[model samples]
Target: MSTAETLDDVAAAARACRACTDLPLGPRPVLRVSATARLLIASQAPSTRVHVSGTPWTDASGVRLRTWLGMDEAAFYDGRRVAILPMGLCYPGRLPAGGDAPPRPGCAARWQPRLLPLMPAIRLTLLVGTYAQTHYLGRGAMTERVRDWRRHLPRFFPLPHPSWRTTGWEARNPWFGAEVLPALRAAVAAALAD
Candidate 1:
């Protein structure tokens, strides 16, 4: 597709993207964005389920994510209020040992610049997981970045990916629930406030 000048145009182009032919499930880009979006969910690549479903955040991880943000499924899925854009639009396949592979190197670089400028209303971006945190905030340990989330300020909130694996991490760091969550919810409320 040609250069996209509007949000709709960009979305269309992203959906049609076939740049990554090596993707295991082929290219089924899953994302949600709108010009009015105030909060951005900057996540890792979609899981196989999400690629098949053609919707962003449709798995267990999504459930926990919505809980973290104190939003219902309806509110979370409302593109006008929240934009869900991952580092990789398509599923990059699984690692031999386990877990999903890292996002394709070029996907975000190819699309973020085009999409972000059009989303002038985005007040805060949630970097959900190592990929997003690294890409946006530079190299750092996930725990450190999340622990020091306040330094990123009203513009960004660093978070661990809400996969089942986090259950253990949450237990280890009780402060995440007691401190970071409340602050995160407040930040989200402020960002989404009318």
Candidate 2:
């Protein structure tokens, strides 16, 4: 795809991207973004359900993420208010042992530089998984990054992936609920405030 000057052009180019031919579900490039968006959900990748639905965060993970952000589906999905951009736009397929595979190595490198510049309104980016946290904030334990969320303030907020697997982690880290979530919701609300 050629250089796209506008968000619509970038999004169109992204939707038509076929760079990663090895993707198990093919290159669906699922994402939701707009130039006016202020809150960015920087996640790992689309799940099988999101790939099939062609909508970012359309599964159980999304439910929990929205809950964490104190956002309803309407607000969460509004491209003008929020953007969902993952490390990999397409579903990378499942791991042999159990869970989904990590995102393709080249996807973010190819797209983020192009897409993010178009979103000048973005105030806070929520790094929603290990992939995202590592990509944006550099290598670190997700628990430590999330626990020290206040440090990355006014720009990025690190959080564990909101998958079913995270339930155990959340249970173990009671501070996530008792502390991080309230701050997260407030920051999100402040970012989205008109």
Candidate 3:
């Protein structure tokens, strides 16, 4: 496969990107993609663990996320089927109190517009966090956007971050597990069916 074309080119350029030159842990752009991917996991940013491993979603949050989608790791990480892009590719560092800082705004602003169009096969985009939700859906709280996920339909599906913080959120919003996950899983299966 002559991956040296669009997917590979953009991916390589994105990997080598030091756009946010002085990132706390340095510019290790952590994202995954394949030209043939039909499912796009448009997330927030890499965590320290994911950054160290050079793999997106190799953390606690990822585990919960996989469970939410009812997807096994093999299916979830299958590069040929799924593309994982975050609002920021690199780890933006942690806060003084705790938790990861927000992803650099510069990342999506600089790269997404150019990179996303290259993959026309993206049938389903799981916007998995406020950052992704805000960018794609625009001007809405994640709760409302996620609650009204039917409005977006087959193209875009909004989801909350699968971090521990969501434990409380999930407890409060029973519909997420009872309603959203089932629909999300079905959508994923349908998208990958071809």
Error of 3 at 22 (Å): 2.0
Q: What is the lDDT of residue 66 in candidate 3?
A: 94
For model 1, name the residue pairs that clash: none
TM-score of 3: 0.95
Which stretches of candidate 2 lie above 4 Å from their native place? Answer: 1-4
Ten-residue region with minimum lDDT total, candidate 1: 2-11
Candidate 3, residue 187: CA error in Å? 1.0
User: For each candidate, how many residue pairs have backbone atoms clashing (under 3 Å)?
Assistant: 0, 0, 0
**lDDT score of residue 15 within candidate 3:** 94
User: lDDT per residue, candidate 1, 98-164, as tens digits?
Assistant: 9999999999999999999999999999999999998899999999989998999889999999999
- 98 Cα displacement, candidate 3 (Å): 2.3
Each candidate's root-mean-square deviation in Å?
Answer: 2.0, 2.0, 2.3
Off by over 4 Å in 3: 1-5
Better of 1 and 2 by lDDT: 1
